[model samples]
Target: MKNASRLFLALIGLSLVVPVFADKDPNINAIKARQGEMQIRAHNLGPLIAMAKGKMPYEPKLAGQLAGNLKLLLDLDTSRDWPPGSDNKSYPHKTRALPNIWTSYPEIGKYGKDYATSVNELNAVAGDGLEALQSKIGAVGNTCKGCHDEYQEEHQH
Candidate 1:
């Protein structure tokens, strides 16, 4: 009887743990998708930022290509990557998206639209000249900062 009771308790414990582990994969995948998209945006924007800062020589053709790539990335519908379970409250350290994102849905959409507009403007003048690119770069950066400030949680490390 003692052995049976121990086995029953162990089975109950295992059952409780199993659902938690099962639910994690979808949340993990969503977080990864969000992170991956951000990484791609950074990759597309890195060269333009370097050129704008004079760290790299401004190549009009390359700048144009990068800007176009950025526009394409911005064009993606990213809402799907931000399901409720993917928020920091659900996944903790694995995701930086704050719970406020779900609550502030309208603001989030506005920010996304504003970012798309800024990127569109950048795409238009990317190959014009260094001066043109420099003028627009700050706006693009500001849009990113605005969204990040409101929607993303600060990283402690």
Candidate 2:
């Protein structure tokens, strides 16, 4: 019985140590952070997209609030989230970021700047009226697509 208890305790200690080692991996943390940021952006944008598409009732105040939240998220400096070895090619199946992002840094930086501009536009007029929001949604989406097209790997069905 004492041996069994010691074995169980040893296994529990190993489990705790394993996660500590995993957390020390910068590549894993970078991928996780970027994925989390994308998830947050999606959460903030979902309702705005639905309203813009006429799938949801337009609420001007809510739209403004969501857009503001999205703008704040976009304004964050996420350079650390794309560190070396975090690309899809290096960490296959863990990230969708293409290696091209590092190679074509200037182009990707432009895309990021454009995305920030789109978010600013959305924040400016999201509360003005549905028409205004609808007008800018396409620009915001296009900015997203511009980066995704070149920097992200295509998803398989």
Which structure among the candidates has the greatest lDDT?
2
Q: What TM-score goes with each of the models? A: 0.82, 0.86
Each candidate's lDDT (Cα)? 0.88, 0.90
| Per-residue lDDT of model 1, residues 1-157, tens digit only | 9999999999999999987656557767667878999998889888999999999999999999999998889767876678876788887878889989988777788888889899999999999999999999888989999999999998787
- At residue 11, what lDDT does model 1 achieve? 100
Per-residue CA lDDT of candidate 2, range 43-145, in tens? 9899999999999999999999999998999768888888976888888888898998888777788988899999999999999999999998888889889
Candidate 2 accuracy as TM-score? 0.86
C-alpha lDDT (0 to 100) for residue 63 of candidate 1: 98
Angstrom error at residue 135, model 1: 1.1
Best by TM-score: 2
Which parts of model 1 have CA positions greater than 4 angstroms off?
1-24
Model 2: runs farther than 4 Å from truth?
1-22
Candidate 1: residue 36 Cα off by (Å): 0.4
Count of residue pairs whose backbone atoms collide, per candidate: 0, 0
